[model samples]
Target: MSEKIRSQFGCSKMMLPEHCSMLREQALAEYRAENNRFPETDEQLREEQQYILDEARAGGKTVIIKTLNSNGCNHYMGIPLRCDSTGNKIIIRTETGPDLSISAAEVVSLTIAD
Candidate 1:
């Protein structure tokens, strides 16, 4: 098997450590067979993104999001409180230490840093 395929299936020698190569290959093949698809529309894309976000929230990870100004400077940083689909932005409780709330129109990026 190719190195790329091996790595994708977590079948690398480093990952296996104790498991046999054949066992790793079987596990990887099962995983690949279970999940294989390409989103065909914007709605599908949004669903996938929401699934990821939901998983992150359920995992108890701190979701930090940053909002940038027109000049590309970071204008806000905080823990995302919730996403408002109608408003198309996230409601964040600012980390600036005084219980401030803000609506971030554009999320530059999200980090699930534990």
Candidate 2:
């Protein structure tokens, strides 16, 4: 007998672990509303984040940092303020009007408001 063919399929690369287009759409809409536009779908936000990170460490640059929340449940975006050598950790002032320090290594998602 021939081997059975697979019926169900699965996705490989994804923006989120689980499919959450609704949540993603909501977030995108909010971003558009805030910046009057949307970020490029090239998924290059991480690069943008890195560029901003470098600028921040060098001093004086506005950046949006997507960092893991303290609750270990969700992510948040903020503008970096200061940093130490190698940019392992940075102090960022969030759009919500507060300062926070997030680890660069732990942060994989981020965006530049450009």
Best by TM-score: 2
lDDT of each: 0.54, 0.60
Poorest 10 consecutive residues of model 2 by lDDT? 1-10
Clashes of 2: 0
Clashes of each: 0, 0
For candidate 2, write residues 1-114 as lDDT tens digits. 222334222333345635587788889988756654333434375566667677765665456654443334336555666665486776777767778877765564665556
Candidate 1: which stretches are off by over 4 Å? 1-52, 75-78, 94-105
Tell me the lDDT of model 2 at 69: 36
RMSD of every prediction = 15.2, 14.1
State the displacement of the C-alpha of residue 39, model 2, in Å, after optimal TM-score superposition: 21
Candidate 2, residue 66: the lDDT equals 48
Best by lDDT: 2
TM-score of each: 0.39, 0.40
